[model samples]
Target: MDSDSRLDLEFAYTTYRDCCRDLYSPYYYCRRPLGHDGVHAAGFGSGRVRWEHRPDHAPHLLS
Candidate 1:
């Protein structure tokens, strides 16, 4: 896979990951427990695995 001209999605990807990471954190839940899920946009069917939405054991997990 290759991008056509200097396309780097690292920023957007990392930002989203960071946001989700925070939201799923225990501290964030303490601040705001209520959260919601979004429908997959590309017709992700029932075959997709449902991930657990609990906080990581530590920040920057698997880094």
Candidate 2:
């Protein structure tokens, strides 16, 4: 895959991992980054993390 596509996949996989590993909200879905009926915040990091998501769900979870 292209670098951009690889980055996107990494972001998606890590978003799922971050939610399961860090987030402890009963409201947020832990299986993966998932949006609520309204919104759910779900991801953060920089450098190696290299990606972040934002609301609608939150981070990736919100959108």
Candidate 3:
């Protein structure tokens, strides 16, 4: 294939890889552990998942 054809093939391959990733393992595939706020601003350093409860809600979590 020519340069343009090769580029098109590479793009197609990347798209297919992303599609498979999203379909099979949308979460926990390449995801790092989230903190209490569920944002990536800062990661928990203790190697443990933590959750913070709202003033009106109870705390819950899974290992």
Candidate 4:
């Protein structure tokens, strides 16, 4: 990969790691309601998907 692409990936990974760490902090946990299954489900579901594309963007790119 090009240097620009590598730099972008590094920046993204660092941001993602920082965000994930923030989620586990006590301050973050205390703000949310208990038994919120949908919130947990959404986080779990997001990791399972490897790729995603919006239908609106697809048609423009394909043409």
Best by lDDT: 2
Model 3 TM-score is 0.23
- lDDT per residue (tens digit) for residues 1-63 in model 3: 863454334334443223212111222121222221232111123432222334564322222
Q: Candidates 2 and 3: which is better by lDDT?
A: 2
Error of 1 at 18 (Å): 13
TM-score of each: 0.19, 0.25, 0.23, 0.24
Which regions in candidate 2 have their CA more than 4 angstroms from the true location? 16-63
Residue range 1-63, candidate 2, lDDT tens digits? 964454445447654535433233434333333332222233333422222234343332322
lDDT of model number 2 = 0.37
Report, for every candidate in turn, its global Cα lDDT versus the true structure. Answer: 0.26, 0.37, 0.28, 0.27
**lDDT digits (tens) for residues 1-63 of candidate 4:** 963454345334443323222132222211112222222111222231112223453211101
What is the C-alpha lDDT profile of model 1 across 1-63, one tens digit per residue? 432111123223333334333223323221111232431111023422223444443433212
**Quick one: how many clashes does candidate 2 have?**
15
Off by over 4 Å in 1: 1-34, 37-43, 56-63
